[model samples]
Target: MCTYLHGPRQGGMYYFRRGIPAPLRSIIGKREFLISLGVKDREQAKRMIPQYTTETQAILDAAASHGPDTAPSPMRAAADFALWQNKQEAAEYQYQHSMEQEEAAIAREPLVSALEQKLKLSVDKLSPEEQAAKDIIDNLKFELKLSQEKRMPERAGGERPENSSNAKGQLKQSGAAGPVSSAQTSISAMYEGYATQPGLREATVRQFRSIINHLINFLGHDIANQVSSDDLIRWRQFLQKEAAVKGKPRSAQTINNSYLAAASVTFDYGFNERLIPKNPVALVGKVRAEKKIRLRSPDFTKAERKAILSASLSIDAGRRSAQLVGALRWVPWLCAYTGARVNEMTQLRREDITKIDDVWAVEITPVAGDVKTDEARLVPIHEHLIEQGFLEYIDACPEGPLFYDPDKSGVGLQRGQYKRVGMRLAEWVRGLGIGQVGDRSLQPNHAWRHTFKTICLEAGIEERAMDYMQGHASRGVGRTYGSNTLPMLQVQLAKFPRFELG
Candidate 1:
């Protein structure tokens, strides 16, 4: 029989069947009765209950309505719903698997990780200052990476597009941002220009050239333009590795000098040429070399000076061409007395020597553009120069070169001729078993300047006046009025005992 449901007096529904048991009827509340009656609202529930009861009564009256052979099982319907859910779950899992495979393929490519490896190696070997420079390079690399990622087109539902052949090409092109070859070219040009100057020698140019060339060769041509911050890091690694391989990792001082020379010239040239907007090489750190100040005086001892002069006279007597020997003998002794660089000494002329205040003095006016450091300076002659027949030598010519060339055919003392003479003098001194002349186990013309400074310092000369005498560029109080007066300089110089040269 069909069941009918009706609402409670308080507005909830209840279900009932015709001739149903009183106990079952009491258990069915109005809410459950309305749900079973398949009516969503109170009005529908009231109407549906009476109609359902009438229809159930009619069906009950027919003998075939409740036949035992026609009923459907509830368990069969539940099994069908479970199968549908399994199909939906399998479809979702397949979609997720496809996405994971795409991500794995992108990660397998080599180009993505190459730049990162390069940077890590480069930064590992730098000093603190150099590491700061590497840091800037690293930032630039990061910028390039981000820019490349931004330019990539997006896919469906905010997913990133897979890496394609065209995208890889674009990334490769973006990676070619550094200008290593240009840097090398600029450095070569700078060294060539610097070597042309009178004071900068060819050997110095060659040494700097070697350093630049080595760096260029180390970074291969194919990857030269593609130098990222990481490539520089790798270069630092290469330098240390090479040093260890050679069994002399070189002092920090040497390596520092090499790097400084490389960086300074490269950046200076790049800045001047407007190549990269700013100097990239300038970020490298400086190397600190130990500074040792020797305090012993530098005058030739009485015996040593006598032996040098005696050797000089012997050479003068034996050799027909005494110009070189004579010049060496007098110039070094003159430097001992007057304190001047070999280059400065070679530029001396008869016009520079003058008598002031009834005493002979040298008027050293460094011609405006002639000085090595590009700063002009002046120094006065000492009484010892006059006493040692220097005045007599100058008087012989009066207007030409004080140390005139009898053979007047070649260039005078410019272009390292004076340096050659100094070398010869060093060889001669070694032959006579004299004392060690200079540092580095090589005879250098600069020793004379050193010797002068040391002698003046030991004699208790004022530090400022000594600095002025040596043409050292120093700035401070009292030094502001560094006078170029011969009388004033002579007064200070006269305080030191005359340097006897035999």
Candidate 2:
């Protein structure tokens, strides 16, 4: 007590003094802890001493509960929290055993006063019959008491405070319906805010949400400040090591995207909100994405294309919902000659395919829904496509989208949800063993784009013109003007070798 008092009698400051326990003195490598109270009066210092005493006792009691040795604060808090939980369970079973359902609904603090009046012991000292009050909230209350009593300083998770070796990290505010200690936004909360940005597509928003969820699951902590570069590193390793495409490790593209998503959510949002001091993932470099895709997905071969055409017309076209059959049937052919992506083919409206000038054309644009580029263009109706009854399919849907699942369609939903429409063809391809080239199978629907580029090059189509026709970003200054206009592109379509489907 005398050591805690220092300075001249005329003017002096009070300090906290606690000798390190013998067993932990060497490990702590400190003889004593001293912190200034910043006070000049003796009475205030006297009043503060009890709080420091109780906090130290709680820490030592936690150490004593586990064994006769002093341990660090996180370990001590863990042991104390465990003991508190056990005692609460015993007390609850003894006094409120019959109240389990109702008690569970009512938070523990809301019922604490009633429990205390009946049992009449401080929660820390567990009695035989009253031992059954092991609610987690009670543990939170005890932890909060220790933190407030000690006036603990800020530090990282699982880190010791500068003031005391036995001091744990700051206590978080209880999630219960009560007065919260402070305003702290969590990782999950940050994600909720990020999801609200306008102009983000449903698919793009979902990807960002998925990145945050991966990080949350990996670190097992939703608190933003607690996250560290180590956590990001482990998560990256997990995605690279555990994420797979057909039992093979994920491509560098997938891994790189995951890292990008995580950094955006954590550093971008967390830093802006001041929830974190700095972005924990800022220095975590992206995985070196492989330039060439290593996935086994391949383009449709000659024989495979022929078989698919046969199935669509013979078996599928005769089904009860012939309209759906038409979508599945012509979708591949539309992709074949036009070199358009699968979604573009499935999402086109009847109005989208109309005669422009003298040439009948397919208008690939955003009138139906969100286009990949949001930039509309015209692909002249290839003679092979029009010859395959495509005009008849458009006539069948004069007022609506040509391809859609009627079950999932609603007023708020986008045009046809062709995710399944695209998938069904991939499975059909897999069924025919068409997805494989050598030992590798083509990535379901995307292989068409690859096949289209290959065929265009083989057909001697102008190199730069292919980009514009396919909705790909154009290259070169002159290429930005595009190789030709809509009518001339019709000529290029005529050059494409036609495959008979009707």
Candidate 3:
């Protein structure tokens, strides 16, 4: 995103060029790095140079940091993949075989337990037949337990090892069992390892990857140990101030989130590995919230709801509207009825909407992507929603998100926030003049929860039941004894009065 062009050359058209650093020249196997901007006009070339410059710099940086032999060769990677496939097949076979054995053992347990109970009085005191039965049962249980332990395949050691040779090459590159991580590990190298760490959520890792990618471009082929606190400060400052000046400024929350993303993963990884003496991000301060971004509404006023519905339906209805996010049409109705999150509605597949014990419901869960509570729950589709051609919409596509394009179902930054499915929903709400509830602002697509809760509570539905419908955990003993069933939730949801958008 450099405004001024730094590298230039002439060919059939103008091209971007960079001379490889002298020390790294042999590793790159080239004197000068080059890429055509694919245009002749100065303005066109300038516009096109950023991408070409970015890509060429990336290639040069990789060569400088990792050289050519740091990672597994292509043939070696393919061989490792083959090994992994074989391991998977073997694991599948083991799993099925183990399951069969476990089933047989479980099926025999009832008879065994019964026989054992029958002989429990005393081996000698029991009848001869009962004693014999106990002996047989005891032996059967012991044999079953032992056989299971002996036959169960232990987990493969150390996650998908690259078919021995590739592993050896990697080991050789890392310096013959010197330590878990080499002293020379680059920032990029550290990120690759950290991203795969156990217990890190996939969603979180992705955020880290995004944050780290930005950091790398700033650091420029920096090694893990070479990055100083100053470097972190610059990166954080760049993200907080400079980067966004060119476009939309990242919110305080975005800045802080980016900070945490890097600190928790990249810096933490380097520190844990002893590659860096201290975490540079540990002292980084959180960005202050200078302005409010109400992502969720405290409550959608009846008037705001009407405006939203009117604007939504009035547009090129049901066609992906340019004025609003993909959900401008059906999302409001779904949110109003079910009280589900925007993503909860947007990420739903046709299969996600199915009858559970005769109650037609949408499974508002994390199957497609991350959910708020990380727990799946059932929200019965309102009769009003079904009546409004919602079922027809669902029927059209039997798979993928109901409110999003199928091809772009799983696409987006941090999970469909910036994909072709559409524009940001909050902006639409703001555009509709549905800005805030009292002091609080309405988050783009989040206010529906407030609306549903208010509506349902006023309509005689219990708060606890509403919580269940909205996928929020309920308090007290009710959660322990009371169940969250489709039929039960359907009744509470039915109490929600459907809106007349027209």
TM-score pick, better of 2 and 3: 2
Say what the RMSD of model 2 is.
22.1
How many clashes in each structure? 7, 18, 4
Per TM-score, what order, best first?
A: 2, 3, 1
TM-score of model 2 vs. true structure: 0.58
Model 3, which residues run further than 4 Å from truth? 1-182, 245-248, 290-297, 311-327, 396-401, 404-419, 422-440, 473-482, 500-502
> After superposing candidate 2, which stretches have Cα over 4 Å from the reference?
1-183, 196-199, 241-249, 272-275, 288-297, 317-320, 407-416, 436-441, 482-484, 500-502
Best by TM-score: 2
Q: State every prediction's TM-score relative to the real structure.
A: 0.48, 0.58, 0.54
Model-by-model lDDT, in order?
0.46, 0.57, 0.57
| lDDT per residue (tens digit) for residues 1-502 in model 2 | 4444443121245555566476643322234444455576677777766665655556545544454233334544332332222222222212211111211222232244456554555667756556665554467567655654453244344322112121222343222213321344577787777677665554445545656766765664566666665677777878788834445676555565444444554455554444554445533445665566455436777776677667666644544365467666788778777778777877776788888768998888877665667788887877866877778868877565677755444443332355445555656656766664344445545667777788888888876667778888654344565345777787776777776544
Error of 3 at 219 (Å): 2.8
Candidate 1: what lDDT? 0.46
lDDT of model 1 at position 109? 24
